[model samples]
Target: MNGLLEDARSLELDRLRHDVHDHPETGLHLPRTQQAVLGALDGLGLELRTGTALTSVVGVVSGARPGPTVLLRADLDALPFPDGPRHACGHDQHAAMLVGAAHLLAARRDRFAGDVLLMFQPGEEGHDGARLMLEEGLLDTTGSRPVAAYALHSSASAPAGQFSNTAGPALAANGTLTVTFHGAGGHGAWPHRARDPIPAVAELVTALSAVPARRFDPFDPVVLTVGSVHAGTRPNIVPAQARIEATLRALSDDTLARLAAVAERIAHGIGAAHDLEVRAEYTAGYPATVNDGAEADLVGAAVADLFGAERFLRGGRPALVSDDIGRVLAEIPGVMTGLGACPPGRDPATAPGNHAPDAAFDDSVLPDGAALLAEVALRRLAAADPAAG
Candidate 1:
């Protein structure tokens, strides 16, 4: 709706979103997605570089005057489902909005005094695409790392056109918890000849499930869910081993570590009670996304200005979902905010959320998202060092 993103550009953004949605690609090897991005930015006259380790694209737009650099990022990956890959997370919309921002910034480069680094990343689901881009020199593309960065993510369960974010701990830290119980196997008819691991496995599950409530403080929350449980195929036989896999989420590093420690201790203690062998593996994942206080204020102001003040909300609870952009924010000062794209006629409370097979995002928010991203970049760049008139 802004003058920067006109009707024609908005239509093109929708087209691009639909095109990308139709052919979704997961993980780091996204050649088609990368090619589509390059084609969209063909005549921007900005310096561009493709990823060597993964299919990432970094573009730099320099102002005629000198100032600090700011980074704008958009992830370009999809989550796979039972049938195939789908843009259930609305990553297609994220990429389109970034492209729109690139166009708007490229056209008005003379109005700002700083450089804008456009980062189009892949493998955000779990492969750490942002880390790979950093390894391949994403920050140095502009000759210096950015002073501040910003990224926007879409939500399928929020009111359309609403912008929400928190100043600190915008998202939780993610990790995995796996526990395997080992015991001796014997004939089902035998009389207490073998130690059955099934009882120990059940006890371990109960102990791990009760960890957050019984072990940690009530104010400091943690979530541990056992998503998978595996044991013997036949019902009659006593299995030699049983396994349980769970996902771990916490708001801080210390809490995450504590959660893992408690789970492992519980499993080992239960194994000792049952006189069986037990092992636990904790695989670390993305860190918690913490926003800089100043940068978060900038985002709130930008959202309030670009849209109405009513559209801007603050101090909401952070999302439990994880993102690799946290990796970048850890290294630089940045803020990652969420844009509401819930489809029309869907209630935010009852609608399918992101990563769900039926999740849907409204394309009407495309222009709003694009304008918001461009406006944030413009405001940040202008505040860095005023241009000489």
Candidate 2:
């Protein structure tokens, strides 16, 4: 609202957010989303670099003096919900913020002394877009691999304008599990003849919970939730096969490994006890996003510049959520800060999460977000090499 931002960029941001909300594309294959971001970066008068591992867009903004480069990123993908194209996770807002930052920096290009790598990455919603970008050398071979990088995620658990950032493990590591139980099909009348898998499936569901609760350490939180179950054709006939899908979360790698072992044990035990053949597959997904202590402190200081320290608190140790940004941090030392964009005047216990169909974002602090991102980029650019200017 103050410093370098202007009215034109703000208007453009509104349009961009609405446009993305109206036409939401799910995950990695976001053509329209990529195009929209491309247009925004192009309009900002930056050199656009496209086709970085399927729809990932990168733009470079050069400063007046020569110095180390910094990367500013925003994800450009939506959920695959049948319930209309909604910006459930407020990614539209993230795109708008990055676009706004690009505009702000471009408007006052002489203030800084380094290069800015503005990335509009696609497929962050469980598609591993960050991994894809990294695989294609998005960060590597680039100018210093970024002396520092920054990205913002809008949070619905807190109020608007008030920001909260975690210094350590901010998000959880997740793994997707798919288990199928197979058995002989027969009529329900003859229980002894039919090798029904229904009981095994039920037992598996109940047994999975024990892994994270009783077997694993109580202090180390890990969760195994069965989100979907499919089986049986009719009530009279016993089903030959059953499928169960679950999402697993853990704060630490050892916990994740232990839970995985426990899951396999439970599946085997249930299948043996119920006389059914069970196959369980655990696919390792996103890892826990661990923030660098120093980088997180720097981010907190930057946030304090916009909103005073009294309103902010360093986030908790970690939570049971996963982010593809973890892949980036694993490759390089960086931090992913959570922004309190949750609607005001509601308790977090009742607030909807990122992927919820009815999730909506409060736009009051969007400009503030834009300003914060711009300030982070400017501050990093200046601090990395003040002698350049």
Candidate 3:
């Protein structure tokens, strides 16, 4: 490890990682997590701003000289599980790595010109905290918008230390769907006497499962998972309303729109056939996380230089996984890369996937992840510096 990565190693990220991991919070408000971040960055002397609508921390680091501004982000919210909220997605690690980067960069503030915006955001798990931060004028923290922005994520299924990202469409576009069928309630024994919504919703579920294969081209893949379904309380009585909730994902916006439209039509058609009124609400979530080609090439070159050629992944298409950072990239040119942090002794192929209860992230990658973030900012700042020429 070089000087920067070595310093990241000594930062002792476990204390903060464990503390936040042990007591994880979700949604827009993460008071305890926010406090932990403030405590870590206490003596750093960076100008900081906290979110009014959310528990977001935006720290501005102005270098000794003036140039352009670069932004780095980390999502701090944990995924909610059946047992309890957990850091199964490795967000805790992301937080630690960014903290390490902040310390490392602060120690050598004279090396880089311009400013660095440290974005510690919440509600990344199906919540658009990035959008929230942008709404609150995150880009306006400095006098001008960031010339370039960067953020990295941890992957439990990839070999540790490897960095992977694509130039275009690194992550998929997504939306959340909720369909409710309203009907008159009656005794189950006399189903013919009244309109029952249970049958409509139940039929819609099966029909939706077949939508991708039947309606969409097999080449352009679409994933629609109906994770939640609800209906009447009593089995003997027909419920007045039945609802089903689903998550939608597509590589392109047009595909996602078509998928949503098909779902709504099928749901309404099923409800009408059953003599019920249907309310299909498809709230569009995050957009496609498209990366700038030059910015992405910079990430690959940095990884290859810092580690080795093998460290930078070659080719991979966008996946169904969605991230709120898409909101930031939409407004500014940026790249969201992925770092493999899967723990040792577990095969990346067979290890439990991210968000799994047993998913684990190796703390050893903290230094590398942190170093890469700092390196990205420095490179952007140097490129923007006229004196560097």
Candidate lDDT (C-alpha), each: 0.87, 0.79, 0.90
Q: TM-score, each model?
A: 0.96, 0.93, 0.95
Instruction: Rank the models by TM-score, top first.
Output: 1, 3, 2
Which of the two, 1 or 2, has more TM-score? 1
Worst 10 residues of 3 by lDDT: 1-10
Candidate 1, poorest ten consecutive residues by summed lDDT: 1-10
Q: Write the per-residue lDDT of candidate 2 for residues 162-197, one digit (tens) a residue.
A: 776777677888998899999999999996898989
The reply for model 2, stretches above 4 Å from the true place, is 5-12, 344-349, 386-389
Most accurate candidate by TM-score: 1
lDDT of 2: 0.79
lDDT: which is higher, 1 or 2? Answer: 1
For residue 139, model 2's alpha carbon misses the true position, in angstroms, by 0.4
List, residue by residue over 1-389, the lDDT tens digit for candidate 1: 34765732544798888888988999999999999999888998989989988999999888777788999999999998999999999899999999888888888888788799999999999999998998888888877779999999999999898898889888889899888889988777872898788898898888888888888887778899999999886767888888899999988877888888888888889988988888889999989899988988888998777776898888888777789888889999999989999998999999999999999999988888888888888888777774443
Q: Which ten residues in a row have the lowest lDDT in candidate 2?
A: 1-10
Give the CA lDDT, 0 to 100, for residue 229 in model 1. Answer: 94
Q: Can you give the lDDT of residue 205 in candidate 2?
A: 88
